[model samples]
Target chain A: MMLISAIILIIMIVILPLETGRFLERFDKGHQNDTGMVFLSGFLLQLVLFFPVALGTMFFIRQDNFVWCTRIYLILSCIPAIAGAVCRIRKLKEKKPAAGPERKAEVYKNTGEEKNGKFRDAEKTILWAAFFIILAYQLYKAVTTAFIDGDNTFYVTQSLIAQQQGVMFTNLPYTGGPTSLDMRHALAVLPLWFAYLAKVSGIHATVLCKTVMPLFLIPFTYLVFFEIAKRLYPEEKNNIPFFLCLVAVFEMFGSVSIYTSERFFLTRTWQGKAMLGSVVIPVIILALLMIAADIRDKSNANIKTAWYLIVSAGIFSGICTSLGVAFSALLTLGGCLVIAIRDRKPKLFAMSMLACIPQAVYMVLYVILK
Target chain B: MISRLWAYLELNIETVKNYAGTGFLLLIYAAAFAYLLISEKDKAKRVIFVWIPGLTLLFFFLPPVRWMYMKYIDGSATYYRVLWLIPVAMTIAHGFTRICEGFKLIGLPVAVALIALCGGDVYHSVAGPLVIASKAQNEYHIPQEVIETADIIMANEQGHRVKAVMPLDFTSYIRQYDTDLYLAYGRELIMRPDAYDELYSMLCEDPIDVEKMREAAIPRQVSYYVFPKTSGFVKDPESCGLEKAGETKDHVIYRDPEELEYMSGISYYYFTD
Candidate 1:
């Protein structure tokens, strides 16, 4: 399963860039509007990059097929390099600039924005300060909790033990039970990846893994918010970008601390799975919202970005605990529906309903499979 | 009134000293609010921001604050007497605000502080003397010895299985290693017995009678007996069969030969018999 996933990932990386380039060329020549195509192409590329790996992991685990899984995983692991190559190739292909006089005029017309650099610098400073402040705060919480309370000890210990046993999945050491007790159900996907890294590197994986989510989440959420802000106030004069970034950082810090602290008392154990879910669920929801807003803003709504968001949301929802998934799916569906109703766009409503299909299918399949 | 105000101030000071994280967070909130007020182009937004500091000041009057106040002012305080809800409530309020605003500014810092504070307690509970108390029986390795003795008797006996009356939670060790032992008496056998009555009966339950033994099946089967070595057991030996099998630093194991011989192949043992 892993091997299959790897191969699929590689194929996606190779194909997606070419597809995106084609879409962009069509848009530039007035064959398609730029707004919807850009979002659709980006969303499609991301889905193509990530979905196969996630699906392959799930399929292999559920079916208990390790052989093909190993092969698929190796192939998937090459995707980043493959993607880089594809990007370079596309860049080279685009190097022969169009020779039309209209193109030169368009290029010259777009270059008159030198005066905004000072404002951009000020905004950049505020953004960086806020980012660092939040990062420092998050680090302090993670470190103090781990040092004084040792929340990550169990995960670290389990990962170390698994590494020693030379297995990706194994029984937790303290359970002292039969061979039937597998702990894969307790650990999540990202933690498993981190544990694999730990096994290879011979270092504690929990802190690094825990740290990676926030780092990725902060930036990803920032991008989503930036897109939303850009659409909501197209004038670009408002400090929406700064505010959005500020909110993203704050939301991450607050959510992490609350989720961490709640789990600390409730389970009295430090497991990264719960924390990962809390962080991922909110970010994914926000991302989906932004995607919906983007699609709505476009002249010809990108059915593809809407589809990708729906599918990604469904997949993420499926991975989380039942109640969490339910809440998130409901929120995304409701939020999108509300926006569609308020905007009175049948296309938006249709897109939202289409997006919801993946989750409904996921829920039915989940029940059947379980 | 003056004394009360002094008491409140002293409490906040002590809270600052003990939980410096919270203090630092409060300072950040204060600074942010001050900044908001100074930089306010909007009158209503500035007023709203001012409430942030005011709310923090109000948090200083809660029970934990009162306890801290008493501790600092009069040097009298009990651990559990301190109100723990104030910080938790404030943190929750802040979290809600963050959620509403779709921004995390104040909520995140406050949460970090609270996690740091509560995490300290969790760590102390797990690794400190409380851990020692929880594992007193295991540390002395009484359960292992009991299981070994039971295994010896089971090898020699001809019965289906041995019946052993033991404590509840500690029996996991024997069950882990051995497959055919039955628990005749345990916490689950009697639900919420009076302290003295339960103690007296638990101490007295005999391990010899096959009819009296609780049957536990194989594969999922558990063997061996475990009981706490508290004071009441010594006062009532007939019920408990307080005979010394062996001694460890923390507990003593006890067994009765009559019970062992009944199922000649069956044996009963205890880590602290």
Candidate 2:
């Protein structure tokens, strides 16, 4: 049963979301983007779409019928997953013309040039080794650190409540009563969602929370950072991976004088706040850079694409942590304003405002509910 | 205090020392930044490099912003500081290529030193802590015992609607057996508390008030007292109408009223007035 659940989880969360993202990427229409990043961008979208649906379902379900509610929630979520898979298949078939193989070859030839200094096979091997090793080391750190301390209890207990009781924002697990969670708890509905996923996936919530997320999200985080790097240094695209390896290696290089990202990323990357700080915030910054690039290049379509991603990122941030929506709005606005003022793009300022709508809406609704 | 800022400077340096093996990676990071500021001319890139860290540092220093944050925000200064993390690392990584180009002769040495520094950090921050945490049976570093004890309490409860009154730390939210079995003294900002302070006061009342303890606890719906292995506060609950129901390595579960509460009395004072 657990194995079956794990397979279902992978299909629903990992595979389906990624495929949906790929299908969504086709909507970029003529934009020249890779299959991988397009698939990844789906994750942010999945979070955006999944948060509302899952929370809405949890909101109305009978409080005691946790198993039934959870089973129903999983079935409802599969609708999108299946739809995405079908859409991606249809999209792929549409893209594949009668002479598709020849066109694919032509496209490969067009994109074949090694932009960064061409690395030898050994150099590539070394870089890959470094990436994997660093991921493993951080995994070790996260898995080993005791989750019994600090706010971990809050996170773990909430996930357990979700898994065992099928409760979300209702049965106040820590205190155990029927009070709607406070403003802080109300905003943090992701762990409950995760608990739902863990139950359906058959993976233990602890393993899913501690090991799986850091192992996957950290590298995915590196991808986001690499995107940021590429934006800043467009000419040095090839060097991004090696630099990312350094990021992996220097996992503990935070200054003790002040709190740094490593403290959370290494220790609490599984928690929502850490995800907010490490992944969501950085992705927002990346979207800002993408929007800036699009504006500078005068590409309206790419600018629209950038906006979609930023708003999706905003929604994810809002769902991930209590302070995430506020931080995202402030940070996205602040970043856009500074960049716009520098580039003299007043219109970019309006677009940046548009980016905050998802978070703003999420924030206002939660406040109203409270 | 102004001195306090500089005082943490040394602590920060120690953070580098312990985490980064005396901050060689940091020195490389500094070198990369200094090299870029000197040689690189892209203003946008320079701003991107400093953007997150610069804003975070400003937020850290600005008293008015801190005041506003404390007023509006509900998180910790230490944690929110996580905002600056990847930006700092990315900046270091971003500037590294420039640093390599700027300092061509010793670039390999810099790379070699960085890899070594990564190893040291992994040892101290990752591997070493994990080793210590694994060995932490008594739980100076990890509280696996406390966690297991929670499971024991839950298993013993067997889905019965029971609440345990114990030391705040023992009966915390972390000590969970099941949804039905709740601890009386939960951690902060809990929902629907069941009058813990009054019951705690009764447990510690002079000369060990037995009838009152039973009346206040079990009647109020608190069914158990999760005492520690060491007899400190409620040394002998036998005199107070609590019999040992279960025992774990770290805790002793004592059921109140010995058996089913025939009367259990009206807990009117336990709730309203």
Candidate 3:
């Protein structure tokens, strides 16, 4: 049962996002080949899309009973997911008649490309192996060892409460007594999402968080880093693997202090705040790179999707932690402002601010409710 | 306001120091950023590797910017997160990789050494044995004693939910395993200096007065008292009606017979409502 739930979680996080990413691939010619970006786009698409419906359902219910909210939200959110799947299937069907020769030709082209590509054979293979070993080691440690943190009193307990009681953040985690709505934490419903996963999978929330989550999060974060590497060294695909090995090593030794993102990633990867720091921030950086690359190429036609990515990242940020709103806004708007000024494109700055509407809305809600 | 900003700057520097321990990674990052700024020919890569990070660092240190951030978002404690905007590892990796690409033979080993030196072992302990990761006691990852303690209490609990006062160490994990086990006061009070509870303070005090503890627990309807065996008390708790119900490896569970009877009578009505 536990294995099944873990597999289900992996599918929900990885396979569904990949399908959604396949659907989103149509919007950008550049990112079609970048699997990391596609997965990120699909992941953000899920998050940004799921958030509003979840919030609306929460509002409609008014009592914050996460059991019903999660159930209904799960059903409703699957509409987009199913639609994305249908679109992918239809597209595949359309291509099927022509796919035989085209697929063969594409495979031949890839083989030729690989022969000419800058990715060195032996060195690239070694780097790739090292990266996988590091990833596997991290996962092994995550599953076997437990890093105790104080904040779980709130975050994990919130998931456990919602799983056990069907309520949201209505009960104070420390004492297990009824509490008034904590507007600050109420809107950041990552823990509720954990509850939803636990409820559907029939796994205890604590085990899902402590043991299962890191398996996905660590790899997912590296995916974002891999995307960044592709942007940084696009011409040198070999360098990408080396970059990942370095990132894994840095993260392994990143506990310079308790406050560093590396420390958070290693110790508290399951938490929303850690997600914001490790995953969402890096995705935002990737968005900036995508935009800058498109702009520099004067292939500004497909740049609209990058802005959408920023918007999705912004909402996804708010979904992770309320503080994520400010951080994402600062990165998106600030990075855009810099890019705009340096490149002398005022429109880019304006579009960046426009992309921040979701974040802005979340902030307004937080302030009014707070 | 100026003084506040000055204080904030000092706090920010402290945060930076803590985050950048030994400052080796930052030094490597600075060198990487500089190398990228000078040598990177790609315009798009330059925007990410050079421009965005430079501006972010400027904003991070700028007094008015720091002031606005502190005033609006959060304080200096979390200010270190702003530094996260810089792609430290990526920058260093990219720069070092590019630099090493020139000297193909020894470059990889040199880059590896520099990075390893820059980064302290995450599992390295500053104050004690370096055993950061250990086999989890249970699926919950909380202490096995906490799980045992919860099991004992749940076996003895007469009500669907019962209140207990345990040592501060167990406050966070007890309710996580079983929400029915309520704490009179919790981790929030211990972590937050402003928050205080009289019973919690009394229970934590050395040589705890049994009669006074009884006085405090009565009003809160605290049915169980879990104390470390090493804990000192002014008098035997049994003298004040708390009978030893069970014992774990590290803790002794003493149940208030009166509180249990009271809870038995009122629990259904008290809890279900």
Candidate 4:
């Protein structure tokens, strides 16, 4: 099943870029001006890059050998992609023509006019108030619940055991089956890393580590909302940053409440922190969409950014939960197809297939391992 | 009547405290909408219309109003009784905003009143389920003996790899130990009287077909036997090889080398029989 999926994914990726290129050519010829084409082109590009990695891992790793190899492949693929994309984006920015004097004057004028607005001041006050209120509440709940719950202790102890064993799968007393430990879930890494740091810092770190997890969601929530706000209202960019901050506050509080109210729902000792990791998948997908939007805008034509987003999304998807990565990729592809159909851009539609190649590869690897 | 009202109020207060942040955000949104309406700024009104309703609905879904309602509502709180207001509140909020934006408005105090009414409806819906769950947890503390035995096993065990017999679904306890423990009778199989009778007959019948019984009883390897206080064999010790290992106020633990021998000896008996 995985092999077939991988092959289909690879085919989609290889074909998508060609389609996107065709769409761009058409657009240049004044055949398409719609934002839909841009979305399709970016989506296809994401598929092509992601599916191959998923497929490769699926084919190469046997079920017994899959978990660690999948994790390794995901991390290896993601880091370089993120680094490469960042470099390419930086290079692209440097190469762009500096804003003309007229554009700079306009930017200054807009900034000055915005500063004089009453609503802006009110919005800022609201945003800050919400942020602090949510942060303080989440922190309080996390602290109060940490000691009372045994699940955190179990996770910390198991993580320590995994670290000592050198491989995540071996010498772990808790896991009964032969499945790979490293492949368990990405959230496991955070507590394990905290355990390692505590060993170095000479402080009892388990409770601190568990307590800090919901707090991390505060920043993660902000990033996701920021990305969404940017995508939804790019021209009204000044308002987006503030709006994102408000959304972040709301999400942070919601997450904290859910965590405290039903601790069992969010984290199984074996699963580590499923909620935080799951939320990250959507955030990463949104970030990829933002990069696609940036590429389409001709603001910076960074192929590296495209590659980075695809690879990082693949790795994060692999690490978090196989299902989560699969769902996010599916959503992105679906979103892309909608854009393509709406815009009548065949090339962009094709590129969306290409962009999802790494995810396909990861899925393939996951199946073989399973 | 007063007590019932107090119970309802207590539930609402807890729900509000639990979801304080969401309430705070709704208040901000309400304030923002009020400002947009009063100022008569057409652009701001347009933006508020586009964003606020969707945002409110999204918040309602995420903190999950339905789940909250289910948690708090007693048997008395029917769906028909409360569900009518969901759309009504939504429509009222929508209409009030439109009217306020037009400045042919029903005054500032009325707008505030409308927002409060709408917010109150949402709050009531969410409070229904929170009360129910809170009451259930308060009422259903696990039996003390069960909890004590579980604690002892948890403390002594290294991981969920310990084997022991339990009267109920003890996987949750085994999970705490991080061990794979097998029940003497299969957890689900024991639930059926016919299955348990067949299993008991096989284990206790004279000139006991130990081989057949072992096959029936031990799906996984047998590590320990937990004989409840009520078991006839445990009450009259002469009928079985199992010797008392320990006893608690509600239950007793038994260990028998012959039982292990019986299980291990069954493989040989299988071919001979």
- Name the best candidate (by DockQ): 3
lDDT by residue (tens digit), candidate 2, A211-255: 565657776777777667656755543355567766665555442
**Model 3: per-residue lDDT, tens digit, A83-103?**
667877787787753322222
| Better DockQ candidate (2, 4) | 2
lDDT (10s digit) by residue, model 3, range B1-273: 888778867766776788888788788888899899999988778877898899888778777777777778875457788888877877887787788763433566677777788777655523244445567777788889998988888887643677888888899888778777788889988688899888778877899887898887888888888988888999999998889989999899998877673332111101112
The alpha-carbon lDDT assigned to residue B138 of candidate 2 equals 29
After superposition, the stretches of candidate 2 with alpha carbons farther than 4 Å from their true spots are A30-33, A54-76, A91-119, A229-238, A255-258, A295-301, A366-370, B1-34, B42-44, B51-63, B73-86, B101-144, B172-177, B189-216, B232-236, B257-273
What are the fnat scores of the candidates, in the order listed? Answer: 0.00, 0.15, 0.55, 0.02
Model 1 stretches astray by more than 4 angstroms: A1-71, A77-84, A93-120, A140-190, A199-234, A237-241, A252-298, A301-303, A322-324, B1-273
- Clashing residue pairs, backbone N/CA/C < 3 A, model 3: none
User: B1-273 in candidate 4: lDDT tens per residue?
Assistant: 656556655554454445433454345445555544455333322222323333333433432333444563223322121211111222233344334432322233454443444333211122233411111111111234544554554444432334455554332223232223333443234334555545544444544443454455455445445545555431254234445555667777554445442221100101011
Where does the lowest 10-residue lDDT sum fall in candidate 3 chain A?
A99-108
- C-alpha local distance difference test of each model: 0.39, 0.60, 0.78, 0.39
- In order, the B-chain TM-scores come to 0.30, 0.58, 0.83, 0.35
Give the per-residue Cα lDDT of candidate 2 at B115.
48
Residue runs of model 3 more than 4 Å from their true location after superposition? A26-30, A62-64, A97-119, B1-11, B102-106, B125-135, B205-207, B232-239, B261-273
Candidate 1 residue A135 Cα shift, in angstroms, is 2.6
RMSD per candidate (Å) reads 15.1, 6.4, 4.2, 14.5
1 or 2: which has the higher TM-score?
A: 2
Better of 2 and 4 by TM-score: 2
